[model samples]
Target: MKPGILVISHGSREAAWVKLVDDAVIAAAASPCLSDIPIVSSFLEIIEGRLIQDGIDELERQGVTDMYVVPFFISSGSTHVDEIGQAFGLPWLTDLEGDLGTFRVSANVRYGLPIDDDPEIAELLAANIAELSTEPEKEALLLIGHGSKEKMFHERWQEGLLKLGERLRALGGYKRAEYAMLLPDQAAAKLAEMQAANPGEAVIVVPLFLSRGYFTNHVIPTRLTGLEYRYNGKAMLPNQAIERWLERQMLEGLQRLNEK
Candidate 1:
């Protein structure tokens, strides 16, 4: 069976954001670990023409009979991941109503998961906040994510973020690592709570977004107004580790395809 890889991510209107994903995909494709299969990056929405359907059609045109759809999202708890999987004939597991309909597909799909608690992700984040953190023992990391109001989705975010926080703490030897969601607007409250709970520790605010966009640039900073904290606003993009993670996922998919 002819197989290909498709990385699906939440699209942003920011050119830099889109370019980061594309650059990672290109780097992943260039890896020697992967076979010479057609691979592309597609978005769930926002970007015109490069939508999920367009990606499917492009790969199908290349005579790809099987595909692995990898969720490039930060967390699998994202509702978009569930809906997009549903569009590819997976079960609609979420309680939220999805506006995305089924797409035309003739090839067999091998759905891949998101970057929840990958060690590479932990390393990437630790590296990202290395500059902001002076003393790991006296610092606390507060990861901010775009949380959901829905129970199931919110839980998913919590599960992933919690595990990720543990990993970061273990890797960086930080005093504490916690997360806050933007949807429920918990950034400010969480920071204050953390500060009160762990006095004398410097709080480092890290945004759990794929790229440095409006959320990382403006929303996060605005939410934490008047709060004393360290922030670099560096996102999970333009990192070699992420490129390796992408390649590793696609490589594992290739192995799975071969096993079948």
Candidate 2:
């Protein structure tokens, strides 16, 4: 049986946003280590025709009987992550309230972890922020997340961002590092508060997101409009580190499958 991969991401209406995710998956699949593997990328929602079920069907059509699904999300605590797990009939670490509906595929499927607070990912985030921090000693780093508004979902988003914030803080160059969500009425106030608290310090705002899209480009900037901070609206994309991370996950998945 041929082994294949299905890369899942949160779908977007913006063409640029979808392209970013597709590009990353294509680049990662091109790696020599991932050679000959049929890797299909799909979205959770929004985009028509290229949904997660579509990805599964594509893999099955290609004669693949064993499939590994790699969810390319920023947080493990994301409800989307749980929803994807349930879609694959896999037990989740956290209870997900929403249903993405049921999917039936002939291929045996295994799920991969989201881009959680992995040490390597922390390094990637640090690199992205370090470039924005002109003076690490005097600048404060603020990481923004696309948190949920729903009570159950919001808590998970907060939990993951807070943990990531701590890791990013420990990366050690900044005066202070904090995280805030776009929802639950905290993002703008937090940004304003950070700037006010450190009158002279440069507040570098980095988004805790997977790619540069509507949220990173439009929403975040609009929310921080009156705040005094430096934001280039950079996201975690066009980085080789993410491909490396995916490769590791695939290899780990293969190892686990082999063990079983």
Candidate 3:
């Protein structure tokens, strides 16, 4: 009845995107502390043979009686996260404003939180922008993400990013920190406003995506066509910090179970 770690992500057809997640898991699994554990990285969709259920089945096949599901998403506001919970026969949503409630699974399930405004994540953002910054004190930081149009869902993005923005500004010493969303088509306008508000200050665009896929590869560039800004198109992946984040979550879940 040993525990296994199942990392769930929003899948993509892009081989590169899938590889990023796989590499992160591989790196984590290589760690001395986790080398003995059964760690499988799976996706929600778009991969050929790997899906959430496939991951669950794999863990069960490995003789895992307790599975820790680490949802590798940008925000808990994602509808996909809720759907994944329901797919496992867990309560869909007892409280939308708070953490997505735990669910009942074939195996004892321990769910982990999404990467929402964690200080480590904020450090990643600052690092991405720092590469393009000449004078952070004169530049504006614009953090963009796949935001929701729905009222409550959008609020989640706003609140999370606002905290992240504050953290990024503090860490990077930027003149100001701001946020833009793609859902309501506010990214373009927001970028323009940031520039207008601080004339001559460079704007560094940081994408808050889990991987460098379609949106980061194409859509974001397409959307920012007319604007002159600095961006490296880096997504959160292949970072050891993420593996540490997953480990910390798994330990917390394990501790709760031990207490009970």
Best by lDDT: 1
In candidate 1, which residue pairs clash? none
**Candidate 1 vs. truth: CA RMSD?**
1.2
TM-score for each candidate, following the candidate numbering = 0.96, 0.90, 0.90
Let me know the TM-score candidate 2 reaches against the reference structure: 0.90
Per-candidate Cα lDDT values, in order, are 0.89, 0.80, 0.80
Quote the lDDT for 209 in model 3. Answer: 95
- What candidate 1 gets wrong by more than 4 Å, as runs, is none
Candidate 1, residue 142: CA error in Å?
0.8
Look at candidate 3 and tell me the lDDT of residue 169: 92
Worst 10 residues of 2 by lDDT: 92-101
- Model 2 gets an lDDT of 0.80
Residue pairs that clash (backbone atoms under 3 angstroms), model 2: none
User: Which pairs, if any, clash in model 3?
Assistant: none
For residues 15-75, write the lDDT of model 2, one tens digit per residue.
8778878777887778787798888889999977899888898889999988888888887
Decide which is better by lDDT, 1 or 2.
1
Instruction: Name the weakest run of 10 consecutive residues (lDDT summed) in model 3.
Output: 95-104
